[model samples]
Structures are given as C-alpha cells and as structure tokens.
Target: MTDDTIKEVLKRIPYGFYAITSRSGDDVNAMVANWVMQTSFSPRQVALGLEKVSYTYGLIEKGGVFAINIFLKDGADALKPFMKGRSKNPDKMKDIQYSEGPETGSPILESAAAYLECRVVRIVDTGGDHDTVIGGVVAAGVSSPGEVGDTLSLPDLGWSYAG
Candidate 1:
C-alpha cells in the first residue's frame, strides 16, 4: 500500500486522546496526543509517542516520569493552547486546574475522567520523527466512574497527526 494509504488506514484505527504531562524541575509541558496505549498487563505498562521536537519530550527525559490525563469530552477544549505550542508559558496550565498525583509532580487535570502515572522504563527510537516512550504504570485512578460518557478518542473524532 502507498504511504498515504497506509496513513489513512492508521487514521481509521480508533484511539483515545490524552494530555501527557511531565516536568523537569521548572520545565513542565503537556501535549495533546492520541498515540498512546496500554501494551502489557502482567505488571501493567503504557506507551506514549512523543515527537523529538516537542517540549514534553524534554520534560519526560529529565523527570523520568509522566502522567496521562484522560480528559472528558468537554474538557478537550482545554488542549487548544498546548496544541499550538503556547504551553511554553509557565502559566499555561493555570487555567486547567489540576491536582498533583501521588506518583509524580505531573499535573492531573481535575476535570479528567481518569489518570495514569508512569515511570519511564525504556525509550525506543521510532527511527524517524518521534520516540516511543514506554513507561511502567506506577499509579492510576478514575475520578469519574462510568461505562459510558467519558469522551471521544482520536479516531472517534476522525483526528489525524498533522504535527
């Protein structure tokens, strides 16, 4: 299949959207990402894909930990600033309102439906523009309990990776 066709096919695969947060001392960042997944269950593990150029990548590298916040459908609007790279401003997260998770200093949005705190176990070079950040799940919680009405994931909203 052609690369474009392959991308289109990949686009059809449903995935959830998450705000991956991390901090390195004073350097903190979050990215609106859809390419994350739970890869193992024995000890529990989740992986996130971060672009080499993203601010969140540096924070994850230095902090060695990260948090993933599963935003509610209405909460997705909060991601607009970060998606535009305006998260560089220290006060960017102020509007989101969050509480620190027990496992890390990374902010977990108070509005998120659930959260996962992870410690980096390994990072594999995806050999192109992004790095696959594999982290061991150290902590997790669901603030809003439900089998329905969480939020629409990337594919559910027909999102594509343009950045």
Candidate 2:
C-alpha cells in the first residue's frame, strides 16, 4: 500500500470532535481534538492521542489531569475559539466560560453537552508525533441530555485529522 492509500483509509475512520482541557497550577489550556475514545469498561478509562508538543500536553504532564468536553452538533461554534494552537492564539481560553471539574480541576466548558473528568493513568510513547494518554474517568456530568447521534464529529464540520 502507498502513503496516499494509507491516509485515505485512515481518514475514513469516524471520529468524534471534542474540546480537551488541561491545567497545571495557573496555566490552563484547551484544544480541539478528535483522537479520543474509551479504552476500558471495568476501570472506565479513556485514551487521548495528544500531540507531544502541544500546550495541553505539558499541562497534563504536570497536573496529571484532563477533561473531555463533548459537544452537540450545534455547538461547533463553541470549539472555534480553541481551534488555533496556543502558540498562535495565546489567549484562547480567555473568553471561554468554564468551571473547574470536581475530581481533576480541569476546565469543563459550559458549551459542552457532557463532560468527563479524568486523572492521568499513564502516558505511553507511540513512536509517533503523538503520544497516547490513558486517563481514568474519575468524574462525569451531562448538562444537556442527548443521544450519540447528537454529538459533534469531524464530518459534521467537514474536517479530517487522521492520515
């Protein structure tokens, strides 16, 4: 298989869109991420493919906590503020409205339909540009009830992150 073929196949894999928030002391950041999913049932763990150099990655490493803010399809606008990387938009979290999660102290966006607060269980080197962050869900909440179909996804925004 060729590189193009591999990218095409990987892009076809469906992904949910989410705002991943992290904090360390006074440093807080949020970024738009799609490479997140549940990894275990017994321990209620979730894996997030986080870029090694991302601001949130550093925060998570120091704070040992993070939050996945799940939005509805109509809440795409709320994620726009976090689309740009911290290097480009240093004050991205300034205008956003959120409250600290109970267990992790991670920011839970008000726009999120639901959220999962997680404590870092491990960070595994994937031998790629991104590292796999396994977090155990320590707390969760739903502000707006909805089905899976109502959740926001990459396709909903005509975007692709996998290759």
- RMSD of every candidate to native, in Å, equals 2.3, 0.7
Instruction: Supply every candidate's count of residue pairs whose N, Cα or C atoms clash at under 3 angstroms.
Output: 0, 0
Deviation (Å) of 119 in candidate 2:
0.4
Cα lDDT for residue 143, candidate 2: 100
Instruction: Assess every candidate by TM-score.
Output: 0.88, 0.98
Tell me, by lDDT, which candidate is best: 2
Best by TM-score: 2
Q: What TM-score would candidate 1 get against the native?
A: 0.88
- The alpha-carbon lDDT assigned to residue 160 of candidate 1 equals 71
Residue range 1-163, candidate 2, lDDT tens digits: 9999999999999999999999999889999999999999989999999999898999999999999999999999999999999999999998889999998889999999999999999999989999999999999999999999999999998999999
lDDT of each: 0.79, 0.96
Mark the 10 consecutive residues where model 1 has the least summed lDDT: 81-90
Candidate 1 displacement at residue 94 in angstroms:
3.9
